[model samples]
Target: MKQPTLPFWQVWNVSFGFLGVQLGFALQNANVSRVLSDLGADLHSLSLFWLAAPVMGLLVQPIVGAASDRTWNRLGRRKPFILGGAIAAALGMFLMPNASIFVAFLAPMIFGGMMLALMDGAFNVTMQPFRALVSDMVPNEQRTLGYSIQALLINIGAVIGSILPFVFTNVIGLDNTAPKGEVAQTVTWAFYVGGTALLGTVLWTCFRTKEYSPDDYNRYKNIAPKIVEKLSLTTKLANFWKLFINMPKTMRQLALVQFFSWFSLFIMWVYTGPAITQYIWGVEAKWFDAEFLHSVDVIPADIAAAKGAAGDWVGITFAAYSLFAAIFSVFIARIANRFGRKITYSLSLLAGGIGYISFMLFQNAEVVHVNLLLTEIDIPQGALNLLLPMVGVGIAWAAILAMPYAILSGSLPADKTGVYMGIFNFTIAAPQIVSGLVAGQILKYAFDNQAIYIIALAGVSMILGAIAVYFVQDNSDSTPDERAIQGH
Candidate 1:
């Protein structure tokens, strides 16, 4: 059976929804900490608050992927999930702003966060089919470009999400002075924009890029007979347990490396924002409730007074990291072409490790120069420390996105790409669950809010994840190049 190839522009149109989808995702990643803290939630307990993210993801992702794979309706296999997710994301955005108070130990913030988590899975569901759809719809020649276009859209969406709150506060005059660690009106509006875009962009793809009918699909596509027709939860958990039990020689070795790599990234994402705000902004988690009251009069001018020279550098530091990622995205495919997937991955992780190590050495206040330097800029030790590592982190991030999939997609059987990818993504999503549950406790109990040590752990994880890459062994049995590489 032969797969049909869509024209380049059509392929781009089908994958277009990811632009809006990532907008919501980038907003979730960049702002969740800021939002949680503003709503009077305890920063020390934030990792636990974030635990909702993985719980929902682990529970929802496989099921949604399985369900969508089986779905056949007028709206098509992928559309319902997107439409539903968009609706939920909009509601979560609106509800997030109201999360300032507790109704009997159930913080409105927690409730809203759970809603966002639910929305995350629904969005993720539509995502799988689109990837598989590319294989189903595209020939080999255009795939590299097809995926790159999707990546570009994703990055563009992320830039907007990352900067929206900044735009909202600086230009739109939405007060950044929400309660300590609470959601701001401007951030809330960004969500509204993100959600609306998420729904509409997907709707455009659903209508414009049509799926082949079952008979035509069967005529051209080499699909295996459906496995199980459906899988029970017990069965899925059984497979996850098999991650340890009866593990293959290849996979077991990989797991040890994955654990450390993920642990580092978990710490970096969960703690960076609040940690930056606290040590530099001098707004401790312990002072959150007091800062909430100051919302009536505590302006940016006031916060700037507290932080001294560090405040201005904070945004630039974040922008610097994103800029690195934007550039990294362009060269990634070339690196994959040159080094072979596993080797390229290992090298990227090593670079990130160096970046993380640089962070520890550079934390001295004397190390940072002013961006413009006309006024003799001396930023806070904390912000300067974080910015340096972000360069490496961006490189590490690019590898994480491209490598494992390249390995897995090569190996997975064509008949069951959806299920296998779902199972594989478990590593990525499940680690988030663990990180969220443990990061805050580690900060509060292990190090007593000495956030620098936690970030160092992330660097260690990169070194470890790099080590694991060697063990991964590139078991891409079904990859397009598999037969040629084996010289069979």
Candidate 2:
């Protein structure tokens, strides 16, 4: 019943779809707010508009997970769901940046919200299966390596997706500005390229890898199969609730860690655009007309330029973090080996917390020096300041994507991997729901509309998360090298 160690290339092939999946996610994270703002959503109302993503993830992921667990087909179980979700997500991404065109007759908010929901739902549908597949195929000892590979591919895709808008406008001569009530050409083209990457990479994984059949799974679990019948809708709902109420001890502990981790990220994703624009670029909502939400024209040329520049900087910050994530992912297993997963993950989160706190020093200053490879490059202080925090965020992100699953997958019942994994999504989606509901209100009232304060709050939340992670009981097994030395 032992699962054989897959060759390194095979392991990479199994998780490769994440690269494409993350391209869609990176595009959404880096650009969605800017698109909403371009369509004239007020800062106070922005979080409400962003609610569609978590709401959809909450509704979709568990259902897809439960269904996939019971599914079987010629094309294989997880592959079908992955392919379907990728297609739907790619379509949503393609339509997202073009939402302003619908404003001729329909409200831009309504169309844009629909596309966001569609993209989120599709992404969740694919994501759960990808996580479960790694659990399904990889043994406990290799879980960190398998998941970290996915994390590496994720950041690589993120770097490309995050930098696309910046590259389009600054390097390729795309107009970053549109007349009032329209998305910029740079963002529009970025979405186009992201959509293509989403579909293409997912297709690559689908064609190159094959999933274990249900019969093979039954053999692995030492169970005999009778004639299988599909569950009724009522039973699926009952099982979903039952699984929630009876989560394992490890899942319960990891839930606390995931709560703060995702909450801090939700805040960053929502406020980073406004924070940079208002704090760094000195652009305010008052400088432009909100009436442009309904009709075009009368936005000052200078204000539009400032907003465009701020959006590009946000893209650069995202790319910097993704770059760091890619660099750190390769070393995560080695670091985890020396420190153990708990201390390693906790330290990463602590570093990210300090990084977020560093935002407070980002005054509208002049030149900043960055030392890299024995050379010092001088750049604008705002740009240099933002890049420094990403180092910690990237390290924490690598752990976030790998460690919890590496722990929880070992404890889960093999027969119910899909359902339990689906339940894990609650830890991620619920926090975003909480943050989406309250983050904007906190920014407006608590800090007097100072968005930079939200990043500081995120830093505190991450530090608290590091503390929570320190107490979780790790059940991961030792690697083959260690086992052989022990004569196992």
Candidate 3:
């Protein structure tokens, strides 16, 4: 079968929806901490607040993938779902900052999270096919460039999303304070912008992008639409159970690695900010004195003036790592092509592991003041140089974004693309579930609520995840042609 031709720009347009998808993800990642903290939730309970996110993903992703497998529209099968999810995300983003209290807050948070899940599911509807588009469009040799382009877009969107808050409170002069723990006007504005951007950008992809119709896609294989005629809960369960039981052996072995890897990350993301503040910066002493509690999410917000050059530096640090990914994604792709996906994965995990562990070495209870280790002095939060740490995370992030899919897609039976893509996502979600349940519990009992140690464990798990990669034997030689002949 001749591969269909695709221009480089077409790939960009098709991936334009990622502009919005990544906007939502980056905002969610960078801001969720500050939001939960502001809403009177304790540090330990933050994981619980975040729990709703993964739970929704666990419930929504596979079903969405399965449904979209049969769906078709004038725009496209995946496009309709993508549009719907964007609307859901936009609506939820607008509503997120309006929560009144603890339990009540979880209501909007969970509802909002469900919207994200739906949006994410919708994105997945297109995601696999979009990759298939790359596969279909690019020759075997150019596949690295194809994936590199996608990685570039992923990080560019992330860079923009991560810096928006700093732009709002510091530069835009939006009110950053609310009396008695109310959500800040600046945060509300950020959501509004996020909602608007999320929809507007998704719509950009919907119009600018084009997908292979069934006729085009069927050229490579005699693909028939596997429509789910049944819609009841029992029927859904029955279908899912069947798929679960019958998952490919390669996937079965790989899920364990995914489970551990994501769990470690979830723990890191949920706890890192608070850990840095309480255990590292000891910002409590500054704030509890009622003299100077900083409102900056990553560092204390300076009250007297707008952001100085320092805040911009934080944005630079965050974005620089992403830039590193953009540069390195192609390098990783070439390495994977030469060395195999599992080896590239092992190296990535080791990089992240070393990155996380590096924090422990810098866990000084004192900062130099007046050229002395003064007991009576405290340093500002941003004073810690996080450049190396962010770079380490970038390596992990690059691996998380790429290698698993490269290995999975090459090995999976092409006909099962949608189902298996959905299954692969479970690896990302399950870890979030484990982290929300276990990290806080471990923090309390084992480490006396020191969240930094969880990162050490995360580092170790990632290293173990690296080691586990050896277990995934590549079967790229087993092609779609072979699978059909074997009645797979």
Candidate 4:
């Protein structure tokens, strides 16, 4: 029997938790490097420090996915992992920015890195199950729409989380600068709010949506139920290895595309703040270090203020891209249906590549004014120009979040959805891990430690991803016409 078609609200409820998840992630992506820099990490070692996130994801997701596939309890199959991960992630968020307070025992950077690992591990545990849960619930025809809605919520959350630091600093009048070896109040408070948001939305999804029972799931997927058997730990490990070795063709083909895409993204996350600050605002990496600032003969207030402002602007730029992504998500299903997922995805990645390449062209820091109802706000012309490129990045991001999963869901066995989804995360994590390991060395040796050149390299990687998209075979049964109809 075919799975029942879920109503729009039910589909919305299923993915609502991602809003909070992305919120926490947005804060981490936009600000973690900046935080590490504040606590004394140099520009060259920033990506190495960021190795915590992808490393944790690489280790955690597959295990969580396989475990969740076999799990069923009073709270439901995926919900237990989701709720538990959210709680752990929330605690990590609360503590990570405050690592300086625990300096009596461990160095702040070491403690912060541990928290980063915990948060990312928890995020991977929570995220892998959500991907499977959508496949488990949504019917074949509606899968695109379901994932598109998930993308929308993810980008929406990202927008808010990305901007929180800027809002706290500019609107709420919080101190954006901190003493040596500490995080800014604006960033710390943003994490607190993000943690709360993460827990609240996850609870909503946990309470509002229900998972299918084993027998019902079997029926819906048109498969026979197998007898439950207790297996040895050795046997389980062997089974997991078999699954990895025998993953679907489509999954393997998509891995190359994911590698380039995520590699570029990892670079952007690690280098964007430093890149824009040095290239546009004339703020040097050394200015971000409190110890360096303290050791200077005369502390330049203007340089310090410029560094803080540049960091806040990085948050705003991240928010702009997320906003653009959210807007593009509204039409991703339709666009993919009209052009076919391959063409649509390729074109989107191409757009993002062009956007990243354009980063080097606009270096004007001339101030521009926007008149509010009661007052005026001034922003750098170059910063405002950066938003135009984000449009392309946003388009790519919308497709990246939705299309591959929509395509892959059709090829997966129903009972193995969780494990496969978890394994798929390897593609995402592996590239980031590689990028983290080498990006710093490339920046230091290849580009003379100028972060802007790394952004251009990311663009080249994205274009390669655009080209790689043509190799994947989409096995979904629904035609573009059917997808368009369902999307509407």
Best by lDDT: 4
Task: Give per-residue CA lDDT, model 3, range 51-124, as digits (tens).
Answer: 77677667666766666666667977667767777777677677666654434535544544454444445444
Model 3 pairs in collision: 296-301
**What's the TM-score of every candidate structure?**
0.82, 0.93, 0.81, 0.96
Model with the higher TM-score, candidate 1 or 3 = 1
- Sorting all predicted structures by TM-score, with the top scorer first, yields 4, 2, 1, 3
Model 4, residue pairs in steric clash: none
Q: For each candidate in the order shown, give its overall lDDT on alpha carbons.
A: 0.62, 0.81, 0.63, 0.88
**Per-residue lDDT over 1-488 for candidate 1, one digit per residue giving the tens place of the 0 to 100 score:** 66666776798887788777777777776767666655545666767766666666666666665566566688776566656766676566556655655446676666656655665665565566666665545555555556656666666666666667656665666665554434567677877887788777877777787776656665665654444545688986786565435433444445555566666666665676655555555654544333444554543565633322232233345445555666676777666655566777788788787776666565443335545322344456666566667787777766666556555554445545555555555676677777777777777788777666666666777897887787676655324464344232
Candidates 1 and 4 compared by TM-score, better number: 4
Q: Distance (Å) between predicted and true CA of 172, model 4?
A: 0.7
Off by over 4 Å in 4: 288-299, 371-376, 480-488
Ranked by lDDT, top first:
4, 2, 3, 1
TM-score of 4: 0.96
User: Predicted candidate 4: what Cα RMSD to the true structure?
Assistant: 2.6
Model 2 gets an lDDT of 0.81
